[model samples]
Target: MDGDKSLFAWVVENYKDGHLICDDQSGETADFLHISASSRTLSFIHVKKSGSSSEQRKISASAHEVVIGQAVKNLIWMDFTALRTRLESPPIEEPACWNSGVKGSDRSAFLAAFDRRDATSRTEIIIVQPHVREAHYKHLHENGLDHEQISEDTLRLHLLEGLLNAARSTTTSVGADLFIIGSSD
Candidate 1:
């Protein structure tokens, strides 16, 4: 597996027992959406490549913003009734990149896991990069809106709150417990 594909595969393997939805193609909303039945957790993942240079990888400020933005956008989309409906009955055909036999075999469990009435589910917005660096944090502070008035923690909280609000507005009737995870090498 190559860079992007490798990350995708890792995500698939990590959540093998769950319902995985791939949206990595052009014009898609997210790289992958993993909904775990046993845990009642929904994860929206966005994968991006780090800069080639070692220094760049440690300070790719622009990449940080872009990946985080994309993940937030995908989270908002997840709140839509139409998207949730589609998620409930995902296409049977697995993406070519998925490992063999990773496709959802338990249709009943898959459907039940996403049951709109399950109001106590948790949601996560995950951004996977090659690595994270101190520069990324500094960049966020320096470039963030409000002339650096907003802290990184505040910005993340705002985004997560927005996602939870959107999820509540959906037919799911769930008030999602939100979390944001930025994982890197």
Candidate 2:
């Protein structure tokens, strides 16, 4: 479950109980979409895996570029109306991205519940990057001091931290939350 696809599947399996989980991995949408009608929440999940050990230890700005970019760029899809329309008629035919979970009659009910939700509904962009160890982020911020003798990894993590902060700020401005889920190490 460490890989991107596996982690996505894991989310579907574990969180699909009371949610309309959509595996919209197509380039057109988020990697996975979780809609909880009861909670009135929609989560757009983007996933990425570390290519190297160093990347797993600290946030790699280059490695995160695509995932973060996708999360930000697809903010237009955060609308319930747009999402319902897209889900009602997905563009891709072969290997459909929104193929799994809450299909057929169930999808209608899910969409109905979604439509019932109001402006207070919460939406969030979740970036699940195991590559970015949480410890590195906390240490860098908590122990902020002279970076004169900082290692390459620390510098890169700092850069990625800045990027994540900027993304968070931007997401917040639009009445959405931006969450970066990294390893608790």
**lDDT for every model?**
0.56, 0.68
True-vs-predicted CA distance for residue 114, candidate 2, Å = 1.4
The residue pairs that clash in candidate 2, if any, are none
Q: Please, what are the lDDT tens digits per residue for candidate 1 over residues 47-107?
A: 8765553654433335456766675555556554666665554454544322222564434
Candidate 1 regions exceeding 4 Å error are 1-5, 53-56, 88-101, 104-109, 133-185
Instruction: List pairs with backbone clashes in candidate 1.
Output: none
* Residue-wise C-alpha lDDT for candidate 2, range 1-185, written one tens digit per residue: 23545666656654553454454656556776666645867778887766555634555788788889888898887666777788666554432222234333335555566677788888889987777677777777666545668777677877887888988887888789998877665
Give the least accurate 10-residue stretch of model 1, judged by summed lDDT: 171-180
The clash number for model 2 is: 0
Instruction: Tell me the deviation in Å of residue 76 in model 1.
Output: 3.0
Question: What residue runs in model 2 are displaced by over 4 Å at the alpha carbon?
Answer: 1-5, 23-27, 53-56, 92-106, 142-148
RMSD of each: 7.1, 3.9
Please report how far candidate 2 places residue 89 from its true position, in Å.
0.9
